[model samples]
Target: MALTTKVAAGFGGMALVLMAGSGIASAAPDDSVIVNSTCTYPQVIAALNAEDPVAANALESSPMANGFIQDLVNTPPSGRQAKIDKVRAYPAAAQFSGLIAQVANTCNNY
Candidate 1:
């Protein structure tokens, strides 16, 4: 993938992460703590672990992807979709969408 595509996908993932709250709310632990906390790398890891240990472990395994995720979470939520839409023309759009949902689900639960 081009660097542009990778960056856009990162943003899409972030947007999805932010938008992922609807499905798992009932089963999830209280994430109110997230509101006051900054989305630091360690904090993000903890959040993912709290909601999805497998995903968290996977994240912990990749330092570069972890940094990318840290950047994504730090991004303002309002601008994420536009970034996502820019990459919708790519053939990987469908996969990007799926990735967004998965990452968002992980992030949103916390």
Candidate 2:
């Protein structure tokens, strides 16, 4: 899958947790926090909206996003880190690394 697709999947999966209100503890604002299921939908969206409205909008409105989310949701929480780690390991991760960090940093405040 394309790197963007992978990211979309990751975010989509996270979105599910957000909607479910997983109530996970706030993680330190960093890329690693992207795998955390605790960050609420509002918190993540707000962070994304503040940092990159376009990406935030895409996340909210993208049709393929739901499929991506479903893919992530199917994975067990214990394995999410591996999935994220694999994505991060991709060279493409450098391009959106900052965006991920920004979301994590802002959302962790909630």
Candidate 3:
């Protein structure tokens, strides 16, 4: 579930971090040089909970992704129809529910 993403500029455009929970990082390929990193749903919640700097850097790098996450948190979908409606309203909402579920579950210690 790793996704190569864009990082905040200060980390250097060429730098791609990791969230495998191993703390190891590597350089992004030339074709995907803009990618900063990717992680499973749980890894992100864990990293944020632990106050890990890597997660902080990644979010800072991508304002779009960060904003998307913030919007989901502020207004959650009701159900399948709600999710479908979200997609109809904004395409990115499709990813929102799963992320919110994972985060909410983790927060509830599920």
Candidate 4:
């Protein structure tokens, strides 16, 4: 009986560990882009739009792809207009339409 109890306890402990691990995994966001933030770009965009539609529109309309903006972070743009125009062209590029816009935008800032 004592041996059976020990075995049952071991199984329960293992089950607890597994459950805890699953919980931790589930807590992670599937689409988070910020290094430590839970917010995805879509979520951040939504928040920005909510806070200021005009600013959000400007950001969306800006030619810089999201990715390019991120990419140019350290260097920024000496010629801002030119940079925007170039990045905006990415969406028109065949490989960068619709959902690709997100990646392009993300890379813009990379």
Candidate 5:
């Protein structure tokens, strides 16, 4: 083959490899959070809203979140609002809050 043809082929292969790697790197962090029997996204939202531990448990088997909901639900009405504000303000949990908010709005889950 001509040297030019070989050079072009080499660059094309490198580009394909780089692009595939970048795609893998850019993928959502939750991609590894297996969805084994996980509830449909909508069910997740509904369970969250209802704060039904049984329903939430079945939805995602996310004990921590469901447990939080249970505590929130059991809190006095006046205190629950503060708890919610704290939850939304949680730095690490903020991304999830934003995602849920976007989903809720787009899904017309209002």
Candidate 6:
């Protein structure tokens, strides 16, 4: 009876752990949802509008005025806005500002 109880408890714990892991996996964002720039600026606009309202407003307010977005558009590698993704992923404000400066300099001619 004691051995059976212990086995049942162990199985219960394992079930809980598996449930938690599956929940975490489901909660993770899907990378495929991210729209690539080559899809068209309107698609980028729609994706941004759906995913980030504040950033989308900033873009809509002055799409070209945003140095980072403008830079990515003007000198896009592979004609895509991958640079914006790099800038958006910056964890710190200082790093983002630095990227903005770099973009400005790189796109100055445009």
> What are the per-residue Cα lDDT tens digits for candidate 3 across 30-66?
2121222233334544644454446444654576556
| Predicted candidate 2 versus true structure: per-residue lDDT over 46-65, tens digit per residue | 77788888777666666565
RMSD to the true structure for each prediction, in A, is 8.9, 8.3, 14.4, 22.2, 19.8, 20.6
Q: Model 5, range 1-110, lDDT digits (tens) per residue?
A: 43333322321111121111222333223321111112344544463455433433332444445445445434544443334433433333432333333332333332
Error of 4 at 40 (Å): 0.8
Tens-digit lDDT track of model 4 for 1-110: 33223222321111121111222322223212222233345654565455445544544554443444333332322423232233322222322122222432343232
62: Cα error in model 3, Å = 1.4
Q: How do the residues 7-73 of candidate 1 rate in per-residue lDDT, one tens digit apiece? A: 3444333333223233342212222222223455555566556755654555556555465566655
Q: Which stretches in model 4 have alpha-carbon errors above 4 Å? A: 1-35, 68-110
Off by over 4 Å in 2: 1-31, 66-77, 86-93
Backbone clashes in each candidate structure, one number apiece?
A: 2, 1, 4, 18, 0, 0
**Residue 38 lDDT, candidate 1, scale 0-100:** 40
Compared with the true structure, model 5 gives a TM-score of: 0.33
Query: Over the full model, what C-alpha lDDT does candidate 3 score relative to the true structure?
Result: 0.33
Using all chains and alpha carbons, the TM-scores for the candidates as numbered come to: 0.41, 0.54, 0.32, 0.30, 0.33, 0.32
Worst 10 residues of 1 by lDDT: 26-35
Best by TM-score: 2
Instruction: Please provide, for model 6 over 37-96, each residue's C-alpha lDDT reduced to its tens digit, 9 standing for 90 to 100.
Output: 233334434544554455445545552334434344445344322433332322232212
* Clashing residue pairs found in predicted model 6: none
Candidate 5 RMSD to the correct structure? 19.8
TM value for model 6: 0.32
